[model samples]
Target: MENAILLLKHVGYLAVLRDMESFNFSKSLLSKRFEKMIVEEEKKKEGKNEKLLADLCECFVLLNQFCISKELLSIVLPCLLKVGLDKDESEETQKEVEMAFLALSNINEYAIIDKNMYFSEMKEIIQHHQEHNNLTRLAYHSAWEFVIKRFCLDGSLEDVISNELHFAKEAIKELEELMNCVDWKRTKEEREKESQEEKVLLRWLLTLEYFLGSCLLWNEKYSELIRCVVQVYQTAKGNNEEIGSRCIYSLSMAAKNRAMKNEDLLNGGAVNAILKENQLPTMDDVNTQISLKFLISITGRLKGKKKEKMKEEHRKGLKRKMFEKMEEEGYEDVITSFHGIFVLLEGCLYPFISLNVCDYFVNV
Candidate 1:
């Protein structure tokens, strides 16, 4: 069996496996055999069949990776989900679960199955893991990947806006629940102790950022969702730098989207969160650049009597911080570093220009 599989893999590498003649011949030889194996494994009440099932799932995973057919996917997905979601504690079962998820993620990536068709199943699987803590991190990750790949990443924004809001809503809700399961109060020592778990949590946060940012521009629950995004960003900013930067970028996009709609950009706690320290990092990294840009955009959009007052407070606070940094560096240093000076001036003055308050600042 191993030799035959290897020969087929060589054929696949030559592109002959997917050619109609070779594909039909190979499918005829393997398909029924795979089905029979699945049935035999299923019939076993208990035994070494778990390993057999795992090995078979992996074979299907490899096959799907090369090219998936509707027929092959229909047969494999159910078995993969079954073995993948099984709560058996043995290491072999765990391996099967991981393979199942990998195959599922791959299949979803290839658009073999309608992602929406399994949205509810994916949700149930995620919620099961969330409540029971039985699934492996890769299993959870793959489940989320399947959903996000199908619903969030694959389509054009207009297509998602028109046809897929329901999937996005469901996905966002599950993500919120998954995120809520994270223990945000873990001390640094505790986090280090559970570094693997922390890494998993970071992945969840990053995925949430992508899903929220991708769908936010079209989502009707813009305010509610962005607020959740802010919370996730705050929680992650301290745990992981990469995740923190991603959160900031997501928030920036959210702010920009709101500005495009001519809506108040500082809605929710976003304004305070962005300007929390009143000290934008020197635009040295992508995160800082995005962070600074978001601040400029939101501050520019500040309007109305109340928002105007809030805007003034933010402007004064930022300007004071920028000057304080410059003062600490001394006038000569600030003047010598043209880029540094421009960054500070840009951070402070862009909002003024954006708000059309440049005349007021010039007079001062």
Candidate 2:
């Protein structure tokens, strides 16, 4: 504790020297010192004989709870890299490192990327670690989380990513590679035992949604974003039955949001109708209903903007098909609610406008 206080004093002196007139020097110092404490904790755990490896695996959770100095993090993160890369490092240490990376990734607000030049450098180290099957897989997952949460979603970090730096493409390629790895299948025997891992997979899939959705905020990758979500939905469907259904629901919302921003009609309706068929009326909470309504409204918007009559006819045909698919899948309530929504739209929303007319969809 005393050393932590002294470290804070040093950071405070540096802040004053840097002329940070409005910066909260104490908080910054405390954050930095706390990071150092985490490092010490990691070192202490490393010295333990029995669970040295496990301690390393668990280090990131503790480390992630505080603000870490870029310099200190540069050192500590690399040590984990070494453990992940080195055959000699115990398995528990490698696991802890992976967990630490994941945990640190979750608190993106404090990642302080602009000051951490080491972050970019660490990506290369992690990439090398990813070459091995065991460690590489873990590193790949951690790196993707870091990229999406810290770099893609945060506006300031996104600006850094878009600055046309030489490393931007490399980092993005790494992230894309990581995202693509979700399709990797285990042996047939392992597939049956995957239930224990489903929660992990689902959480990661949700994170992928965040990662891909955030990419829409950038200019270059809208189509790729669509592809990513579609891929996730497909992969999720392949893995678990119920989660796959939920993934379709997630994909529907993401697709609707994308179409609303881009003004694309066919894609919008296709996504909406597919997800609508899977929707369960059991999710009667106001928020869920509101989200459903919003998705419908967005689809309605797309329907309004479509120019071709044939396309409109095709979309309606798709909706009817989706309803059938739902009924086949045993979603009776979903079909009923879907029909009710259509009835309300036709009656109170658009009486004179023919269902074929795009204008009829405008009021939805």
Off by over 4 Å in 1: 1-53, 56-76, 85-99, 106-112, 115-120, 123-138, 153-194, 216-224, 253-265, 275-278, 292-364
**Model 2, 348: alpha-carbon shift in Å?**
26
| Best prediction by TM-score | 1
True-vs-predicted CA distance for residue 287, candidate 2, Å: 9.8
Pairs with backbone N, CA or C atoms under 3 Å apart (clashes), candidate 1 = none
Distance from true location, Cα of 264 in model 1, Å: 9.0
Note each model's CA RMSD in angstroms. Answer: 12.0, 12.6
Span of 10 residues, lowest total lDDT, candidate 1: 13-22
Provide the global lDDT of candidate 1 against the true structure.
Answer: 0.53
List model 2 lDDT by residue over 100-169, tens digit each. 4554444444465553544565455454554544453444455555555665435555544434332224
For each candidate in turn, the TM-score is: 0.49, 0.48
Global lDDT of each candidate: 0.53, 0.45
- lDDT by residue (tens digit), candidate 1, 282-326: 322345446556655554454221233245667566545444543
